[model samples]
Target chain A: MNTKSDILIIDDDKDMVETVGTVLEMHGYAVRKAYNGKDGLSQIEKKIPDLIVLDVMMSTDTEGFDVAYKLKNHELHRYIPILMMTSFPKYMAEKGVEKFQHILGENWPVTEFLEKPVDPDDLIAFIKELLDEKNP
Target chain B: MDQGHQLIKDQLFFRKELMERIDWFILLRWIAVALGLTGTWTAYFIGYPIAIWPISTILLFCAFYNALFFFTWRHYRLFRSDDIEYYIIFAHIQVSLDFLSLFAIIFFTGGFFSPILLFIFFHILLTGILLSPASCYTYSVVVLAAMGIMILLHITQILPPRPPLFQNITLPSSGSLFDILSLYAIFSVTIIVTAYLITSLKVSLRTKGRELLRVSKELDASIIKLKALYGMVKEMHTCTDLRTLTDSATKNAAIIMGVKACSIKLLDDQRRKLDFVSAYGLSEDYTKKGPIDIGKSPVNLRIVKGDRFSIGCIDEKEAFQYPEDIEKENISSLICLPLRVEKMIIGVFCIYSGTPAFFSSEDVDFFSLMADLTAIGIENIRNQENKAWFVKKASHQLRAPLNAAFSMLDLLEKGYHGPVDPRQKEILLRCKARIKLLGEMVGDLLKIGIKRANMKMSALFDVDVKKKLREVATFYETRATEKNIRFQLQIDESVPTIRTDPQLLDHIFSNLISNAIKYTPAGGSVSVQLSMDNKKYIVFDISDTGIGIPDSDLSNIFTEFYRSENAKECTEQGTGLGLVIVKEALDGLNGSITVESRIGKGARFTSRFPVPV
Candidate 1:
């Protein structure tokens, strides 16, 4: 297994992007940054990243959910792992997840949800766990 | 002031028509009185008979007074259409008395020598024109009855019998009894024909007037309805409550289309279900069945486009199918309008009629306009609610990260996380300061959201005014002393207890005191006073000899995200939500606040809370 996995960071906040990007980079993961959902979708099109870190609130609050829905519906991207990120309470995150399920049905592509200002060590561990999952 | 003046003007206009009718009647009565008095005086001066003058004058006076009284009473009860009947009857009575007086004068004054008879005849004619047929007949019958009684009395020798004025000039031997009877018959036939003609003409005129009035009234009602619709359209533009706007629009649509019921169902974000938020003319039991899930229902097949459900009507041959429940409720006709906001269909507005083919293209157009307005209002409310929810949730989530950062910084500062080098210590201090700032920002955001959402504090209890003031003053005393500022609390012992959220009260006081300390110079003083006003309100005045607010900024100090220029220059750490929170909290308690300030001298804030009885 590779020590560093390619991680895609999608967020509108410059401070958040810089801080989280640096944290993951220091932990030996190749990190990519996208300023918005549009750029993040294009980045996914260019190459299928190992894990996608998406912000629920970008240009719009539901942009992240919409992108995730589109990805889950696409045949090629349906199997890719996606992680939702938000600076909202756990209940709000759950609501977003439920809404996503409502849109794409029970079979969704989301692997996990992370709160903003993520702990560097915990993020790395979550990524490793997703990578270790059996791919069907 | 303008509104007050307009109200008075409207009241005056309401009385205008009634006033005009009364004026005409009053003038006529006055004229009659003057004429009657003049005639009686002339008769007396002419030596025409003292007894006749007094009787005629008395009758004339009575008639004038009665006419005036009747007109006034009718005017007062004009709102009752039934009172018109009484008015017509009274007018007939006046005319009848006038005719009897005219006949008596003619019979007594040399057999038609006096011209008053002609005046009385024309007056009766006018009365017939103004009144209904029944009243005219009543007046003519009374006149005939009076004449018959007079003739009978004369014939019976109960009264002096007077001959025809031309009897002296004619030879009675040449005139036969047949000639005399024929002349009497001619006069009787003429009077009856004249009365019939006048009465029938009046009846025709009254019927036409009544029909015209009915048409006019219907026109006025339709105009009022149109104006109300215009007002609703203008109101919809400014309305921020989705339920209220939808309810008004649906109800108005139902009325305009003359339908049995109307409803507005908003699709959830996922578009899998519809929630009925407002409805009119629908049974309560039906509304309580909860929102309908579109995917699982058979009715969806009729409305859905492919896999997407249609929000409009459903018909077999009409490209849409009507729901069975709608038909069961006797709603055969319907028009369903989809409400789209930002290109996403968010809701449907529907109108249901009991008659088949009741809704037409014109109705559909009007309903579309209504739906457009409803959609805009719903969008505004949804956006506002979402924004409030996001802010609240974001602030709550921020607390955890902020706490973690603060704790970690605290551990580093206390040397608990191993020995820190000078450079590391400097970084740790900076981190601590930034984290503190972030915590304050989060608190400010939360406060603003709570104020905007009108969130009420959970804890409420009876708080002694004096005790509360003392505690607040004592808590801030240390900070005041540290700045070398004199702090004092003056509590009126007579002030009573108040029901309030103590924690919120504490926050209010703390913010005010902190602001006072922060703005006050080293030697300035701050004082807290509590007293009862004439209204029995517990007035709390916080006066600080700190830099006062400018007059221009005083009015906006309590607005969310608003900061006084002076305050902004003094501190950049504030979130500008403290005063907004204070204002909202006071409003929830049915209290009020006023501020007085003199720049560079001092400031005083007075809050008045109604003392619980």
Candidate 2:
């Protein structure tokens, strides 16, 4: 069995997925890519990853959210964490207090939200931290 | 009846009631005359000797008074019926005459011994019903005294007593001492009792009438206030201009309160002074002497602190601020109401009257309602301005980082930091493209946001439609060329330039042209045609040779975030918000758009905007 920590990236934007995957791979984490939510779910079912990198807007808007909810609720992949990225930080902030509660509440399914075009160094650091926490 | 105008209405009601009573009295007087003539003739023919001269004289006197009352009432009508006091005196004179005639008839017929003396009580009852209880009592006393004197004279042999000619004419034992006493007691008691009963009924009727009058007056005043409030609230919506709002507020306040002048004073920016914002029916000198210092003017400062106060006689106060000014201006009464939005007091609404004690409690209450509505309008306008400002600020902030991201990515693709291989270069190109697309989408979305916020505030200017359209065409030519698509621009010289917002016009053309290019496939053509249609509308026809919209999705073409199946299959980067922005921008211009399309054939959009006069 491959002992390296595995990360699954679900995004419709192939270039963004590749860029993030390349950064995570360089940091010694095995990275897998799925072009859409359906592909990501099937891939995670075959072998669950330590963490999932999800895009807020995809083939259809909110496709990433659908996949994240599916993975978090699945018995086999329930332990996996999800990191969400979006192009519209203001829009996300404008969802108001109820959205914040769901995002930061104790039972929140997603780990964190980050803005798009994330710094390459920060992406690798985030993946390593999530993996270490999950394994430990 | 306290004032001249009030007397007019009360006098009208009184004259109507008096005419009705006079009609009844005239008919009664004629009936008494007829009865006197027939009864005297019948008594003579029946061999019953009676005193006919006295009854005839009294009947004549009754007829004379009835004629005089009727003629005088007619004359009063001609002389202005509002002189109701004259009618009251006339009625009093009639009542006294009625008592005199009844006394004369009773004395001539049989003195206090005649049963005809009971008719004296009838006149007393009429007097009680027609006049006040005090007047009725005085008439009752005169009748009683007249009967007493006739009795005393008859018993003392000073005046001759007539013998009862009619066999039924009985005089309580033929005027003996005890008989006279009992007759006097019975007459006095019956007359007094009738007067009391009639007077009590009259008093209650008057009370009810007065109460009805008061209630009706209050109802009229309230209806006037409610209608004025309704008119002012309706006017508030059309008064989008803040200056016009204040001006209309003062004018309407003056008209509604029946005041000589009205003014609105708002706290200045520093809140240390109250500046006169608007004034109606005030002299220029008076308005110019304003901008009162709140620290120095205690009364005005109290109003600004949310206290309502009024002065019934401004000229009488020695230490009053603006006393000299108001005295010169002939302003007698003044009311100041605090204009409040929720708990925050923003200004004072003031009304001045030339007559002292003019602003009643009801007037103040109505003014308070108006001031509260004005405050709400002020708050509404302030909130709209704040929302517009916030939108501008937020868009500016959002645009900064998005542009930064686009520039940073551009620098990255240019190998500013390092050299890149073919594989890295390909990846960089994709990233740059994605970044560029996102940047464009954000810019379009913000344009929509800003345009919505600026609907009320956007300034208009003369625009060269052809020039703007050509500029947009040039800007999008490279994007069209990248896909090997052709672009054609046609402008009819007859389509003159129009007046519109320049930035909004640019957005309109840019969005339509950019959408055409974005949706059209390689080797397709996009053409724009602008011309004057029917001399009233400027028509724009933009046709694209590309994937056409489905019939089922045509209705939702302008809905935000709605992309058709064909569109999604053709392009992954489409935000589906461009047409929505275009439609909204056109709506602001009072323009309309239509589309015609068939699957795989092509699509064409036509727009028409009314030509500005």
Candidate 3:
């Protein structure tokens, strides 16, 4: 049964999502892309992927975090792994109090956080590790 | 010291006023002596058979004392301003002499029923004003006792009783010793009652004055706090020019403080001069007195170095540089307070009054608070000013383009563009590296400009030091692994927790650790060691086996965008702002960092922060 691991990439930046999706597809994984949280949620509803690759580097700091939190809290998709692309965990520890209140947690809703400008090989290896752990 | 100085000033005022009162007292005694002589002569001329020898002798005695006091006061002032106790004693002596002379006049003219007896009330009032209540009551007691003695002597016939000077002085027309004693007793009671009334009235009046002062000071403080709050809320919506904002604030300061004028003078660092920036309630001619050179005016120089001072009178001394000019402008007194945001002095705020010694100690305290608020307000407005706002917004806008370009170059450099010439590939690699550095620099500028303003007020929290360090160390470990560098992290088991802002601690560790990883060559070691120093502080030692800083460049490493010669050659990847941000973040935590390096042997940065007391 020629079944490939399905992956969904969600990011506000269309080019970033396309490039990252192209790299992931090159690694023999079937890929899907969504530009915002709404499209990402609906894409998951159509077909749950093996792993969800999300980008927390967005126009607003909390939008990405809100998506991760919703996915983590969902009854059906709570177990699905989310690989969050964010510079925030290191770039700025916490911004203002009001902005950081929801983002301030030792246990982030995502399975792992990857810094931006991530190396292509490192990206493949991290996704492989998350997919293997979920399927194996 | 200020309290003592205020005391001396008050005493100076009291002494001058008392000296004038003494001059008036001497003049009045001479007038009384003249009246006595004329009254005695008239009694004789009208066939009253008055004794001339004793009355003339008494008059001459009064005149002698009057001359003595008058000449002494005119030639040599006995008491100085600080001699407040001495002035009290002088007043007592003068009052006592008057009482003795009055007693003599009353005894000679008539015993208790004499018309001159009313003079005792005036002396009692003076005593109440000059001396404390206890001393005033003592003087009244002495006067009454002297009258009793005269009556006693007359009754015993030891001193002959003279006829009443004023015939039919009272309705009783009584000259008997018992009537005199009864009248004398009543007179003594009246004197004591008058003294008690005057002293009590004086005390209650003083208490009310003190109450009013306290209420006024409290009211002033409330207004200052409210003004600061209102300014903060209003400034958020409107980005006003610095001069326009400060000019309005200065104008309000004058109205609130009830001063003649208020002004601000900012320190011009390059010129080493103070420039008058904004002034309210001052004439244009006065404001155009030109910038005051710090070298020429030691007062302003000290103020720029954080000093608060005041000049009581512009004509009195050279406490300010343009004292003469200010005097011509009808500004008599001025208070110069350093407007300090944190420990740095931004400028001087002056409250000018047309009256001498206008600012009280309370005024200094209130203005000092206002100056702090003003300094902070100026910083706030300056932060949102065109330059700062542009840097913040422009850097943010620059970051997006840089990142997009970088992402595209990163994809191409990763061979996603497929087969290309070796030379072309080298050029693309260089472009990627250059773009990466540019991106990091853009990020660093954002950190310095916007992040700093947001994190100005450090949010302190009790941090598990081991946890925060491990988080930062683990993050850098991966980066070090990618660069083929050996990274080691050692945390002492006995490492105590710290009360500091988590972001600041994270910022320091992240920047310094990243630099260590970025600078070191492949196969070199980078290590982070956390330990306690004598239980006073927790120390973080971040060492790298990399190209060390030159001896000459070590001092300038923390300056903004300052990169060492070796660092720039080894890596064109640095933003040259990592160490600067590190040092500043460390300083915000009340921590210090020191670096020691050898040419080829690597550098170790040791940072120490105080433990929670």
Q: Pick the candidate with the highest TM-score.
A: 2
- Compared with the true structure, what per-residue lDDT tens digits does model 1 show for residues A1-136? 4456788988877666766676667667899999898998899999988888887776776788878888888888776788776766444466556546633688655679876545556777877787667332
Per-model DockQ against the true two-chain complex: 0.07, 0.03, 0.18
Higher DockQ: candidate 1 or 2? 1
Across B314-408, the per-residue lDDT of candidate 1 in tens digits comes to 35433323255564566666777777665666777777777667765756776676677777777876766676666665775576457546555
lDDT for B534 in candidate 1 is 85
Tens-place lDDT per residue, model 2, B1-613, is 3597786776677677766776677677778777877886787678767776767777777777777767765666536655557667767777777777777777777877677876776787788777789988888888888888888888787786776554465544454688778878888898788888999999898889878887898899889879988898888756644566788889998998888899988887788888887899889888788688888788887898888988888744543567677788899888999989899888889999999888788788889999999989877766766675566446545543554455456446655446778888788778767766766667677667766665344445688988888888888988999889998889998877777777667767888888888889899999989999899998889999989999999999998789999988987777778888888878877899999998887899998888878
Q: What fraction of the native interface does candidate 2 get right in terms of contacts?
A: 0.00
Model 1 residue B469 CA deviation in Å:
8.7
Point out where model 2 deviates above 4 Å: A1-136, B23-111, B132-212, B268-270, B284-293, B312-333, B354-365, B392-548, B561-613
- In model 2, the Cα lDDT at residue B364 comes to 86
- iRMS, all models: 6.3, 6.5, 3.0
Q: TM-score of every model?
A: 0.49, 0.52, 0.45
Q: List clashing residue pairs in candidate 1.
A: B303-B310, B304-B309, B304-B310, B314-B320, B314-B321, B314-B322, B315-B320, B315-B321
The segments of candidate 1 whose C-alpha lies over 4 angstroms from its true place after superposition are A1-136, B1-96, B109-120, B126-131, B138-263, B270-273, B280-284, B292-375, B386-430, B442-613
Model 3: how far residue B57 lies from native, Å: 66
Write one digit per residue (lDDT tens) for candidate 3, span B78-122: 633357777777778778777877787777776665677798898
- Which whole-number lDDT from 0 to 100 does residue A68 have in model 3? 75
lDDT of 1 at B381: 68
By TM-score, how accurate is candidate 3? 0.45
